[model samples]
Target chain A: MQELGSFLEVLISGLLAGVLYSLVALGFVLIFKASGVFNFAQGAMVLLAGLALVRALDFLTRLGFPGWLAIMLGFVFAALVMALCAFLVQRYVLGPLINQNALTMFMATIGATFVIEGVAQFVFGSEVYPLRLFPTDAWIAAEATFPGGILINKLDVWGGVIAGLLVIALALFFQYTKTGRALRAVADDHAAAQSVGIPIDWIWFVVWLVAGLVALVAAAIWGTKLGVQFSITFLALKALPVLIIGGFTSVPGAIIGGLIVGAGEKVAEVYLGPFIGGGIEYWFAYVLALAVLMVRPQGLYGEKIIERI
Target chain B: MGQFKTSYAKDMVIFPIRQDRIGVYLLLGFALVLLPLMMAFHVPPFRTDYFLLAILLPFLILSLAAIGVNILVGYCGQISLGSGAFMAIGAYMAYKFGTGISEIGLPPLPIVFAILLGGLSAAFFGVLFGLPSLRIKGLYLAVATLAAQFFFDWVFLRVKWFTNYAPSGSVSAPELKFFGYLVATPVEKYMVALIFVIVFALIAKNLVRGNIGRQWMAIRDMDIAAELMGIRPLVAKLSAFAVSSFIIGVAGALWAFLRLGTWEPLAFDINRSLELLFMVIIGGLGSILGSFLGAAFILIVPIFLTVLPAELGIPITTGTVSHLQNVIFGGMICCILIKEPLGFARLWQIGKEKLRMWPFPY
Candidate 1:
């Protein structure tokens, strides 16, 4: 019964953690879907957002600003800065290398990662920063006692609801709006979309802007969970395994994959850990993704194509 | 003389022309025996102090790791950020085997063999991780491989059994010797490492020149084209993973046994993997000699940066040195990649081609 209780608790936490992971992976998927450039700087972007939040909070405390206003200002600053980064990348790096293959673009992104890391470390000293979200008492306590009942955190629940709603809103936007239609058209095939008079460049710009905004939100929630730190970049790396298990280009796949990895890692750590001397949780997600990849190269939701093209 | 040189028998020789054969034999003979003798006998006082273990071991191990990476990224066109994880696997496995055998008094040969076996185990894991390459490409594949890196690091760091439930969570290598000659000294360790690196490098060079190498190149150039050309993607890709991992595994062993002699899991972290990848990229991906140049540049340049600043009485703090190191390292990689995306090997090739036409303007 104790083991069963622990397993349930692990499963619950895993799913909740998965929701946050989905948000991060969504940022990756959106960018990849619009522009085939794999943004190696995604992790750095998360760090940037978390750092921005901390800086904003510190300033608010000094200036005697309200908690809510400070938080709002931090989000605004993060979103604006990320959007600006997207614009710069699109204009300078991606524009010149528009005709280059995926490999070249990937290299360019790696360069971007170095620049971000170097600049960030130089500006903000290489130390962990703590970020506090408003409403600390928002956690949900399990009142019913059935052999050491699990109490789920309200912050996680709020994060899940917000993430789900955002995903739905995005789905709706893609389904209905003209810009969304154009974005979809571009994603399908740039040349084909261009021939039909869809402004490919504008669509690409907007996609990146939205993706950056998503990253900002992800950064905030994760910062609240684990405290903002430079190592948060590695946490963002958690999304890559999520991407592998989920299809690279599929939004739903990202969400589902994140949940599976989050839940899987947590449960493995709690259970099978003792057998292998524990901490299999760290790598279990990737190994699971690898196993899945071996079985189905296209991933869970990825389309299967015959390779003779 | 032209007719004699043109004979198939003379042309087909391993050293081909007479002068080439003589030069080859002379170089090998020196490297095998003469280099050791020279280092032992003719070392200046300043140079003797310069031969610090920290400086030499990182160079040797980093070069080996870079070669391992070059096989995958350079030859096979597989991008992996998990080479460090494989190294960790090797180190921990070696540590585990090294201690386990010695604790039970199972002789030194078996213990030494255990280190090689540790490397083989890492190779096994490498192939396991490399399987995803069959589907993913470019960045997705990079992310996928990264999972392997994180997993292995976590396993080795957090798992107690792997560390033999040691209280401090670090492992050490016992005194190693070969044929009753103690290899406890820095110079002796350097010689052992040099021997293994040379042997593996030769095997890597020969492998790259063979049918397997051709298949890897074909897959790299165009997987579809290669598949149409009757090359099996699975076979070619997996073999690349296997061989690459094998090389990396050995490097990991050297790192633990010789360099650290005692280390924890953090010794083979993600940063090291990135460093190895950078070595391959800066070294020229497809060239065997490029691996050495890249490794030397990456490993040696930092030491030069750190030392040259201090040697001239320029008193730079350690923190400042580290920060400057990052900035310079980042800037150099960008510059090198931008100037010669083909890497240092291409530069070597250009120089060689120029040497062939030394006196003529044409």
Candidate 2:
């Protein structure tokens, strides 16, 4: 019973961590669905957004702004930075190479990743900063008559709730908005959408902005949890396995995949890590995703790929 | 503009044109005579700058690895981000075989034999990781291969047997001997690397031009169509993986033994894989010459960046230099992709064509 209780606690924490992973994966799904380009720079964007927010908050607080106002301004600044990034990416990258092969576009994004990371490090400086969105001393726990009590970090719970809200907000945005429908139309058929007088470029810019906003939220939550640092970029890589496990085009798939990967890695680390000298969490998600990929090439909920010669 | 070949034999040679053959011979002659010529001439930079010689061996090794990656990504159209893992396997395996550190009391093998064995070991792992390629492809295949990178990193770092129970998880190269001569000096190392580069590059060139190369290319262009045309995807894809890994493995052995001499698992991390991929992309995909060009670009640019600020009478911190290098390198890659996706190899071809059409308006 004690073991089971501890397991439940670990599982709960893992599920919360998975919510943040879902947030990052959400950015990838939005961009991929709208643009048909896998944005490798999303990781760098996360780092950039977090760095921007942290620096802005620090600056605003230094200027005698109240804590709440400073935090709000920081978020506003992050949103603006993301909007600028979307504009720049569309203007400089996607605009010129509009009809290139997917591989070429992928490579271009890698180049953009390097550029973004360099710029972020240069501008923000490579120092770990504490981004305390919530008080660190607070804990939320369920009172249960187990051998040891289960303790949950309130920050993690809040992260999960906010992430859930963001996912719902995005889903509704895509479902109800006219712009969202047009975006879907463009994703379904680029040329057909263009012929119908829908501005493809404008839709792309909007999608990138949405992805950028998602990146900001992910970065904020993740950065607050584990101090804003360069290593936060790697957390974005953790989302790739999630993206693969969930379908690349499906938003819900990203959420489910993140939860599975997060919980799976935690469980494996707790149970199987001892036998394997621990640190198996690094590759467990990937191995699991690979196994699933072998069975379903398009992924669990990905649209079926059709190829005609 | 050029002499016509009278016989099919003359036309069938690797370099049919007399001038083209002469150019290649001259290039080889220059490479063979370079060190001796520098020594005789008492060249100040060559004598004083150890960095120049030091960079050469790794450049050659990385070029060879780039060729391996080119085979998979460029020829077979299968993107693999696990080249570093194959390299790690090669390096560790070579260390084991050369040092006789295995469970079996194996005699210390010759350096060449050990390196080949190391390459074979990497090839074995390559085939194992490549099993998913039969089912998945493109970016999916890339992620699958990434599993190899992470798994091997964990193995080399955690498994003490691979490191011979070294406390630091680092290994030094065993003495490299070839035909009773110890390869220790920079010149000797350069010669070893050069010979390997030439031999393997020729092999890659021939492989890509021949029947098997065509089969790999067919699979690359369209696997289903290739399969329909009686070409086996299994054979083509696996062989590409095998051959590519073998070459990459040998390059890894050279990198450990000839270049670094003492190294840890971190040397062949994901960053190294990305750098190798960048070399292939910048050099030219599906072109052997592009590998060399790309390697030269990747290797020399950093040196140039490092030296430029110092020469310009400006004092700059190393951190700032590296930051600037990253920005410039990233911008260059983006520019290259947007402007000339074919990369430097295609530019060279165009230059050659222009030269051939010199003195004519057309």
**Per-residue lDDT tens digits of candidate 2, residues A131-175?**
989744545355466666776778878888998899999989999
Note the residue pairs that clash in candidate 2.
none
Candidate 1 CAPRI grade: acceptable
Q: Quantify all predictions' global Cα lDDT against the true fold.
A: 0.78, 0.87
> Candidate 1: lDDT over CA atoms?
0.78
Writing each residue's lDDT as its tens digit, candidate 2 over B1-362 gives: 67788898777777766777899989888777876477446686677437446577778899999999999988998888899999999999999999885478798788999999999999999998998999888778878988889889889999999888999889999988987899877877888988999999999998998889999999988899999999999999999999999999999999999898999999999888988888888888888889999888988878887788789988877777666767776777888888887788889888878888887949
* Weakest 10 consecutive residues of candidate 1 chain A by summed lDDT: A134-143
Tens digits of per-residue lDDT for model 1, B1-362: 32267576666544444555687679768756775676677555314625646665677777888888999999999888999988888777766676665566754344467678778988899888887788776666787778888877887877777788889988887667665677876678877887788788888887987899999999888888999999999999999999999889889988988888888889988888888887887788788878888888877766787789778989866655555665556555655655677788899878856866788949
What's the DockQ of model 2?
A: 0.68
Off by over 4 Å in 1: A1-9, A64-69, A91-93, A141-150, A172-179, A193-205, A274-276, A305-309, B1-52, B95-107, B110-115, B132-144, B158-165, B304-339, B351-362
TM-score of chain B of 1: 0.89
